[model samples]
Target: MKILGKITILLCGSLLLFFTSDFPDFGDANSPASLHLSPYFIEHTLEDTAVPNVVTSVLADYRGYDTMFETTVILTAGLACFLLLRIPKRAVKNRYYLHEPTGVTLRFEGDKYPQESDVFKRIDSSWVPYDIIINFTCRLLIHFIQIFALYVVAHGHHSPGGGFQGGVVLGASVILFAISGNLRAAIKRFGEKTAALFSATGVFIYAGTAALCMVLGENFIDYAALAPILGSDRIMARSHGIFIVEIGVAVAVMAVMIWIYYNLSSAGKQDEGL
Candidate 1:
């Protein structure tokens, strides 16, 4: 089966590469893609959407339904992993601790005693000696990573990045925490319930925004109709609406990535994980 899968992938990639030979040269002005809609999108994006970033305007406004469905696919994958693998009940055996003073390890049966003093630090079942460099460096970098991710999302209208890209970066920061520190710390910071809620809320914000336009007497996902609510002109309303939906996409994608990571890493046991 694995060999067959590899052959299939190779065949598909070969076919795609062969087809690419017939495609127009890069930046060819006479190409069909360049002639048909690309020109119009490039010329009118600023006027129509009031967003300088043509890619963002197209993805968040013109092609929003597709992006929504893509986000749904991500959410679905997370849910499927959770449903299939999440273990509600599991027996934990050994509890590991690190003795700070003597640099020795201690293991206790079942759970650790409640009255255990601060001499020992309770560690994950798979815990290693605390690496001062990795832990401290991650602590220092996590904040900057999150802030940069937010910047990418918010400034995508004028820049190259967008919600999907920004969300992936944000998710990577959390995953970095899991890698540099411990999965237990990551789970404690962003629990399963919170991640699920974030994923749902993001999709809701996007779908609800589209529905709102319908309620305002326009077609579904039409941002122009949001003018009244936003106290802006039709073009500006569309711009703001795009930003709003982009935010939703970012939130959903971020949560789904984290959720999938947690499930796959722990095999859904929700205990110590990579």
Candidate 2:
């Protein structure tokens, strides 16, 4: 059976390779896509989608199905990482705490710890969290980065940014928070459950929008069908649909990035990250 499987795989690979040889070469002007598809999109993108950026129109309106699936792929990766790496978090027997008053850190074994003091705070590591520069810098700049990420998601249609880019920035901000302090602090601000929920919600927002178009008696991904709900003409509705989809992509990407980082950093234990 193994030998037969190997032979079948080899035959399939050869057949696929042979077919790929007939595909158009890179930047071939005479290629079918270049000759017909490119011209059509460049000429009609603005009129069709009412988006100034041709690339955004192509992605969010023209190839919305592909973008939706791409978002699904990120969710799948996060789920896969969770399933493969996630382990039940055990009750911590020992912990580290920092005394803010005197710049002191202490480790406690078992459940015994300092009786709730305002000066002492829980820390992921005994060594890293008390840095004067790194912590202050990250805490100060993280808000700006988050705000910029929002701008990217909201203003993607008019410029060189979009959901994917915005989501990456948002996710990176969280990751920077993790790296600046510790995974425990980052997780506290944004919990694991929240990340998972956001990832799923992002996908739902996108798929729901498509399904809505169908429910409204139009083609599955036809944004023009959203005219009634969006309170706009077909072209404007298309623009609105693109913005909605971009938001979904941004949400999913950001959540997935954070989720994967959390798992990998803590080896799925959600303990003190490296």
Candidate 3:
């Protein structure tokens, strides 16, 4: 079986290499994408979408479906992680906690303590207020990170930042909170259920905007149809539509990042982790 597997792998690899051998070299100026697609976007994006950032226009307007489905894909990945990594219950023989005053680690042997009470259930093994300097410093920076993330999302039409980048920044803020404090602290503020819900909500926002355009009697993702509703010209409507969908992307990406981190870092328990 092992020999057969190795042979199959080698055959597949050789076939893939053979198929791609004739493909254009990386960044070939004469390639189809560079000659046609890139030039078309660069020349017409501003006029068509009223978006100064060609990349943003291409992502949110020209190839809107690609991004919508990509958001769906991110949601699917988060759901898959939840299904595969989440463990409903866990057994333990020891418990640990951090003493806030002295920063001493506390350990309790055996498993005779409380289990069901909400307050006592998750009392053991917490890393919160562990360090005064690090905790305070991170707490202060979290607000700025989140603000910058929002700026990135909103300013995407004119600059390099956008939903994906902003969402990553926002998610990193929460992750920092989790690290500065504890997993339970993070969970208390932004639980797994909330993260999953927010993830779905973000995808829904993007898809819903597209559907709204279709229902408004235009082709799907045709933001020009939103001119009347947005009280703007067709081109400006397209730009506004891009902004709306970028918000959706930002929300989805942020929630999914936190959700995946919670599951993977805690080994599916969501009890305690770095």
| Least well predicted 10-residue stretch by lDDT in candidate 3 | 113-122
> Positional deviation of 135 in candidate 2, in angstroms?
1.2
Better of 2 and 3 by lDDT: 2
Candidate 3 C-alpha lDDT tens digits along 1-274: 9999999999999999999988999999999999999999999998998999999999999999999999999999999999999986354456665444565555766756444343333444543335889889999999999999999999999999999999999999999998887787898899998999999999999999999999999999999989999999999999999999999999999999999999998888887687
lDDT of 2: 0.92
Q: Provide the RMSD of all predictions against the true structure, rounded to 1 decimal.
A: 3.3, 3.1, 3.3
Candidate 3, clashing residue pairs? 96-125
lDDT string, candidate 2, 67-111, tens digits: 999999999999999999998765556678878899787889875
- Supply the global lDDT for candidate 1: 0.88
Candidate 3 regions off by >4 Å? Answer: 1-9, 90-93, 97-129
